[model samples]
Target: MFHHRERRARTPAHETALDCLEAGITAALPKEVVSSTVDLDGKTFAVGDAAYDLDEYDRLLVLGGGKASGGFAAALADRLGSRLDGGAVVTTNVDTAAAGPIDVREGDHPTPTERNVQATAEILERAGSATGETLVLAIVTGGASALWCAPATDLTLSDLQRTTDALLASGASIDEINAVRKHCSAIKGGQLARAAAPATVVTLAISDVVGDDPSVIGSGPTVPDASTFGDALAVLDRYDIRDSVPESVVDRLERGADGELAETPDENDPAVAENEGDWHCLANGRTAIDAARDVARERGYEPLVLSSRLGGEASEVGRVHAGVAAEIAAGGDPVERPAIVLSGGEVTVTVDGDGTGGPNQELALATALELADTGTDAILASVDTDGIDGPTDAAGAIVDRESIPPDESETARRALAENDVYDALDDRSALLRTGYTGTNVNDLRVLVVPAAD
Candidate 1:
């Protein structure tokens, strides 16, 4: 829920955008998604179309790490109750009282820390201890790439941290960045599944990636990796951050690519092949977008879902969306007046300056400028579904023509140029802050356009 709903809902249009966002995030909550997707009847355990006989397994262990893993673990813990044999999961945010019996540990996000390494080691240890009769439930979600940190041999936590920074600043896509990360770590790229080999490893995931690719979600700890070490090296080369990244990272990726080190398990690998069918994506960007669309229709607005797989530089994407709004306001080609345009996906921001703001914030800022320049009458709101955008505490931002008034247009443009949209939005009280929403299905944006008087 929004922290100060009244203050942010400045107009009826703004209120509609907020309502859609809330509904979309609420639909993907782990508690809500898990209860509907997973069920237990006596010894029978069901997830999606697959059902397992719990009595057949000697032990049931839960292991995972991510932004949403805590909530997911808690929900599962409530379902299994005494049947759970106890396990651990690392998260950036967690409600201790709601965690039931699962050991919920805190970790850093967007960057790996010593605490993350320690917590992840415990998870690997528990996963490695699984026997043939053990049934392992892995909760993989957004942010696990950092939460489940376990450096490969000869790599240090600092090495990973530096690499993470370089990759993030390089404007690499999540898939590309994760390809590099998977090779530099021991627990990613199907390695967790390897550690829990022979045991039935069932992965319950909340997809935050563009296409819901299992291998890319949480770096595919439980699924087979389609990328190779060569792919990682190529990503670094593509970004031209090879020299900027830690030498140790380059060495590890190079060694793996040269076959001096074993590659991440592919589809043929037994670690993943055995229980490959057990990977389940409980919710995704489409799930959020559709839920938001339903809310838009309920508000008497014709909703047009742009795409759930949108990608590219954030500011450029914002310009495209602004163009669509201008067209709809003029000719109403895509949809008639009084329409709500929606899109959900992860967008990248190429940080060229030492400015603060996430992709969603940058996008909203750019949209405001474009809308004002073209005299388009519309209101746009964007937020990371997880309730945290970039490194800032704000969820994202909201903008309209007045967001960047004529007198303040120069200041707003300067902010976007410096990648500091967070401050600019804050100046206008346009920043959308909602602590931690306990769910992540990528970024969600809603644009509301009203009919001409």
Candidate 2:
């Protein structure tokens, strides 16, 4: 799915890295996962290994929001066919057409917008209408936290927007950001499950968070919330953005912390307790990582999956990957030469410059610089499995020993300092752009080293 496939396949190692990257991305596609995991045989419907007798339910309603919700809903609709009742799904990518009875609605991502609020309202409405005999198939995936935005009654959309902006800019962990979001939102933190009370709410989730915590994914709209408003306030304080965020946000969080506002439902709450057995995670970062490793081995490289839960600052993580490559090159301690080291997980970028780039791009650029400094000949490729890195059009970037010219080293250093790796990489045609890969399982990175000469 790499758009610049020809340009990226400049060498044997680069081609292999791209192949592994494509394999990971393809394996995580929502449609493929959904179709493989969800099946229907007459009245017997199964998600994963759990089976639900369709005859036991009066109606089958779908409710969810996320980057992959559209594709997931479509795949599910195809499986359920005429047996499936009407449903609603909110997504960041609105290009996909609605299928069966699912209404695919447009929403925003990374940040919520007016359209997102409207779309989420409809989803909540659908959930609220569910009856005890209704079986609600809830789809929760990456980016749902933003796409399913519905601020609490005391807070306005603008308040949520400001708070979200501050949290993203602060480089806070996804868990922390989601902790705050669950409290500030009306539909998050198991509130959706509460709204669908008495109904059999079965959540089908594609985890993007590092640990695949169901409560953190989409802020746990269909699951129990372990975080409280006090916890949300603490996150803001920890990030030092408490005073910088909107006054409405601060006041609401303070009220919630002071017990003036009802907290989001916890695991023991009635809504969560009643439907505790309904949640299921179909795929995660490790799913893609393992698939990539298989591909690497098929390509004749000794695949080493370093970690599926790697985290930290993008540039810092890049240095760590580079260091590992250096070790492998020098003595092949980790694995023999002609090894493919793979890792998957989300990384953050503490944006200090106005430069345009995402975590994967910054990670690739930083690793390229590190490899050049240490005279290491290795190929590094990083990409967001969703095919979009930050706000840039490129999925990520790829770099090798020859990616940066000897004379342009100083110029590359300046770009990296300014967090403007996009321009630098784009100039060299190093950016890996793949429009929209129809799935997301965090980030995928591969380091390919040829046999020692």
Give one clash count per candidate, in the order shown: 0, 0
Tell me the spans in candidate 2 whose CA falls farther than 4 Å from its real position. 95-98
* lDDT for position 63 in model 2: 91
Write one digit per residue (lDDT tens) for candidate 2, span 191-220: 999999989899999999999888998888
> Model 1, 412: alpha-carbon shift in Å?
1.7
lDDT of 2: 0.89
Model 1: lDDT to the true structure: 0.92
What TM-score should be assigned to candidate 1? 0.98
Candidate 2 residue pairs in clash (backbone atoms < 3 Å): none
